[model samples]
Target: MSLLINIQYMPYVLAAIVVILITFRLWKWKRSLNYWRDRNVSGPTPVLYFGNTLTALFKPFVYTEMEWYKKYGRIYGVYGLVRPALTVAEPALVKQILVKEFHKFRNRMPETD
Candidate 1:
């Protein structure tokens, strides 16, 4: 009967919806991550939904900065959400990027406006 068809497909329909939502979320996360990767020097693989860090939100680990340097060298990127942070080598590069010409990269983030 028609009832049998609907009942049999109910689980499949729910599974499909869940799959779609998970896929969408992953796609968005990757897109945001890639924006930094393209500009970054390079680094290790990012954890799924966890990112390149194991640190909690808004909390900087005592040796987190050193960890990045030790693992990825003085040049690499750490991503959390939309942040595209770069850990640069060469103090001159830092001066050039941060102080000498701060205006060129004023905001730590990009805005849609």
Candidate 2:
């Protein structure tokens, strides 16, 4: 009898769990969308899950990048599947990051035999 009651409540528990998971995912997506905006970076808007990936699907990657460069200027942010990425078009900034900031961006790989 106790087992029968547990089985009857199982579906409700499963449904509640699913609803919670969906809500969390949507909240995370919304938060991720605001990442660059919070930092005052400007760029194209992204869709819920696809981000700017769908743009690249229909257009050549290089042309898409060029369009963004022209529209957003020397610095912009883009989303690669909900992950925000910064693009620096200015040569001087790139040089600064590569040379002056090399320590901050050093590769972190574990040594192995």
Candidate 3:
């Protein structure tokens, strides 16, 4: 046996797929809201969409890092346009990641390696 569907329903199917994709993205975004809180890290409150991108852009990146470090202590969290990012102020940890274990980087710069 064979089955066939009307061509007129194609648009509806496509629209449903789009809706599903959008809904999934929104759900994922909302689910990430508690990431830092769950981890016990603290940082500045984020704005609607820009997050810390604008502050990082206008002022020197180090200044922003310092501000968050002063406020939140050795380790803190920030958002880069809704994406959670972690900042570590510990020099030893930074040295370990940049030098001792550089090979573990997923996207290591070709010039650096």
RMSD of every prediction = 5.5, 4.6, 4.8
Worst 10 residues of 2 by lDDT: 104-113
Worst lDDT run of 10 residues, candidate 1, spans: 53-62
- State the displacement of the C-alpha of residue 37, model 1, in Å, after optimal TM-score superposition: 4.0
TM-score of candidate 3 on Cα atoms, chains taken together: 0.60
Question: Which digits, one per residue and each the tens of the lDDT, describe model 1 over residues 7-62?
Answer: 99999999999999999988888777776567756775566666766564456764
Clash numbers, per candidate: 0, 0, 0
Q: Write the per-residue lDDT of candidate 3 for residues 1-113, one digit (tens) a residue.
A: 12346566778999999999999887776667557877888888776456678897788988888888888898788887777877777999878878988787555434422
Highest lDDT among the candidates is held by which one? 2
Model 2 bad stretches (over 4 Å): 105-113
Order the candidates by TM-score, highest first. Answer: 2, 3, 1
lDDT of each: 0.72, 0.90, 0.76
- Tell me the lDDT of candidate 2: 0.90
Lowest summed lDDT window (length 10), candidate 3: 104-113
What is candidate 3's CA lDDT for residue 70? 85
